[model samples]
Target: MVKSYHPETLEEALKILVETHCIPYAGGTDLMVRYRQGPGLVPNFDRPVMFIGHFPELTAISEKNGEFSIGACVPYRDIIRHPHTPEILRQACSLIGAPAIQNLGTMGGNICNASPAGDTLPPLSVLDATLTLRSVSGERKVSFLSFFTGPGKSILRDDELLTCIHFRLPHFTVEGYRKVGTRKANALSKIAFAGFMLKEKDMLSDVRIALGAVAPTIVRSRELENRLIGQPVAELAELMPDLLKSYGKLIQPITDQRSDANYRKTVSLRLIKNFVLKEES
Candidate 1:
């Protein structure tokens, strides 16, 4: 049997999560569907679920001191529509699913689900997002890169809840986001890519690249980033293929229902290369 608890306050929610030792569900896009299909959403939970949707603490997106703080329960629609949200995240959100899915899915749910094919992870990785995890005990920040251990896995303790995602709005950065699926939207990505380029006086000074679905976890490669930085924009076309090859070396994709390993590997490279070149121009 499944037990449910809804707490109106953050402290109350945290206390319940700790007391029950249950999984947290906000948007329920992934959790409800998975639970309906099987017992796999969160397996073997001795405690019931603590619903944070009603918690007033986790439902806003606000900016302060050059950083945006996104409450865990803020739906994708709200994030995409918010005037202050970054353009890359907005574009990614628009491609997430249909209007209803967009309205129901929250950014925090996406992160905690920890799907490699998750649409928003690559964009968040580019932004160097920081996660704020809370429990009855206290709260702490975790870098996005170090947060996920694998598919459906994260560093978040069972007693803890992800409260907010905070990150700086890109400055002097040209952003790009792309996802390749069977359909334009609402299709799970076989391969996805996102990047941000910082140019100084027409020269590439810094670039961050993140890829999804091609790896067991969403990943950003420092070597590939280093290879492209300091190079002239004119050379990106020639350099793209090699960079893709390097990216493949970094991530070993698997054959899954969505796509074959070969296609995912090749398309991801092509997509990243194309996106980077487009930003360069």
Candidate 2:
């Protein structure tokens, strides 16, 4: 029989994880859906399951120094409503699923799901978010860029729980997020893009671009960013072709049910171009 553990404390959760090796459960939006079994369509808990969604330690949102720490179980609706949430992240959260899903879906679950089309990832990547993971042994922080190893995979240890996502509060002069999907709402992304640009006078000083659902993981090219930074925004039109070509070379989208590779490539490039040309107001 499948064993289930619901711990009220982070310490108890960590202990259970270390001992029983249970599948961590939060939200259950992805887990329950993926585990539906047989013609009867009952949810399967093939392995031991542990519920960590209600732990107070994993549900707090706080700020320290210049960084904001979002607890692992904070749902999309809470993130969308939070006053200090970054605009890019807020916009991304607002676009995730519909009202019911948003209310129950946690960012930690989204990150752990490791879907290539995850709406929150591109924005988190652009923000340079870090994840704090805690295990029975101790805790460690990992960059969001290094977190995912591939589609549906991450570096999370079986005994560790992701505690919080941390990032410096973004202060971009202009920032934007765009996701290409079949419909405006409740659709998975074919390609998604998030960009942050810091304008110093008439030149772009700091520029970060992240693309999602176009690779095994969210893709950010520092080499491309280096090429744009310190360049005058007025010259963006002249430089766009090469930039687009560079992005075309970097993205390796696959043909999937939601979209074809060619279409993803075309739309992703166009979105990048549009992002560069947008003016801060």
Candidate 3:
């Protein structure tokens, strides 16, 4: 039998989190599958389960102070459809799954779960997103890049819960997102890439590239990004091989059921080059 609590206010919820030592449940899309399956199927759940689905504080998404505040419980479908959300996030969310998963899964749940293949994460990483983690005592902010510690782990503490994700809108950001799947929708990414590049007056002023399923964590190709900076994007198509070389050095892929290391690396570079070419044109 599972124990549940519905705390109306965040303070009440935090208090309950402390007192009951419960593993907070958000959408339960991931947790429910595990709870029913058995021990090896899911991570061990020593604590009781606390439901935060209906918590009023975790459901707000609005703009403030030149940045957007995305509530932890806000579903991917809503984020994709919201007029105020950045296009990169919306585009990523659209490819996360069909309507069913998007309607039920959430940005916070995705981040907190820390899945390397999480569709929304690479986009958020390129967007320079930050997470707000809160507890009864206080709140702290952490960058999206630093938040994910490993494949299925995060910097989040036991007593802390993710409150909101925040990001500043880029002035000349071109959003590019692509996923490699067996089919178009509702397929796990063999490898996925999201990028934001700025090319004004034919000069590559800036670029951010992030890849999922190519590494233990979502990786930002800083070396490739630096080499691409200040170059004429019109000429970048010729530099694709060198860029791929740098990216290949940075990413550590693995042979898994979904795909192999070499294939993952090849496509990772190809996708970035493709997106860069498209953005420049």
Candidate 4:
């Protein structure tokens, strides 16, 4: 039998996690690989595992007041189907992997895995999403922006569990996600970009930009976007050179098996330029 605790309720699950210090098991897509034992043998985990994948408390998508709450175990397919999911988020989830993986991968796993290349991150970053972390003691909220400490690391505590994600749609006339990878599908991204631009009467009202797989964590610069806000959209052509140069200083991509730093850097700037000056290129 699988050596995992299948709790009947969220409270029991949290209690098990705290007492046994067991790793929370959801889809086990990433964890299984990370802890793989062999071709046919069950994955080896250092400790007991708590299976929370089917708990209704962690699998439902619902809304209250003005905010939308997506459970931690909610799959990408569910997110893609939800009418309330932001277009940017939906696009990111749609391209995370093939349909099979999407059906099993949860945003909680993507987030808790904390890989810099995790596809959902850039979209969630720009969305200004918050995660609800629950412990037997109580619960508190954490900003997604500050959740990740570095590649493969996060601020989530040992006794806590990420229960849900929260976000509200913001006004943006332009929204898009652009990813550069070896293959169109089922490939890790060399660079991923999520952009949101709000322009009014040809004057830029707001700009939100996020880049992933180029830094320690998902890269978002409110400072850079603010500089472009309130500027004439037509004059973006004149401003882009300097803006791109500033971005060049902000992102740090390392050469990896998938791609090199120079190529990743070039493609990132081009994608950003296209988003900002949609009319020109």
Worst 10-residue lDDT window, candidate 1 = 37-46
TM for every model, in the order presented, reads: 0.92, 0.97, 0.92, 0.96
Q: What clash pairs does model 1 have?
A: none
lDDT for every model? 0.84, 0.91, 0.83, 0.89
Query: Which residue pairs overlap in candidate 4's backbone?
Result: none
Per-residue CA lDDT of model 2 for 98-128, tens digit only, reads 9999989999999999998999999999999
C-alpha RMSD of candidate 3: 2.6
Residue 87, model 4, lDDT: 85
What residue runs in model 2 are displaced by over 4 Å at the alpha carbon? 38-40
Ranking by lDDT: 2, 4, 1, 3
Candidate 4 regions with alpha-carbon error over 4 angstroms:
64-66, 279-281
lDDT of 1 at 62: 91
Tens digits of per-residue lDDT for model 3, 1-281: 45668777888889998888898878877777655656556545666788776666677788876788888988887888788888778888888778888888888898898989888888889889999999988999999999999988999988899988999976554667788877878888888888888888889899898998889899896767898899997798898887777778878888888888888888887887788787542
Candidate with the greatest lDDT versus the true structure: 2
lDDT of 4 at 179: 77
Which scores greater on lDDT, model 2 or model 3?
2
Worst 10 residues of 4 by lDDT: 272-281
In candidate 3, list every pair of residues with a backbone clash.
none
- lDDT by residue (201-264, candidate 4, tens digit) is 9898888999999888898988999889999988988999999999999888889999999988
lDDT for model 3 comes to 0.83
Clashing pairs in 2: none
Question: What is residue 133's positional error in candidate 4, in angstroms?
Answer: 0.5
**Pairing residues by index, what is the TM-score of model 4?**
0.96
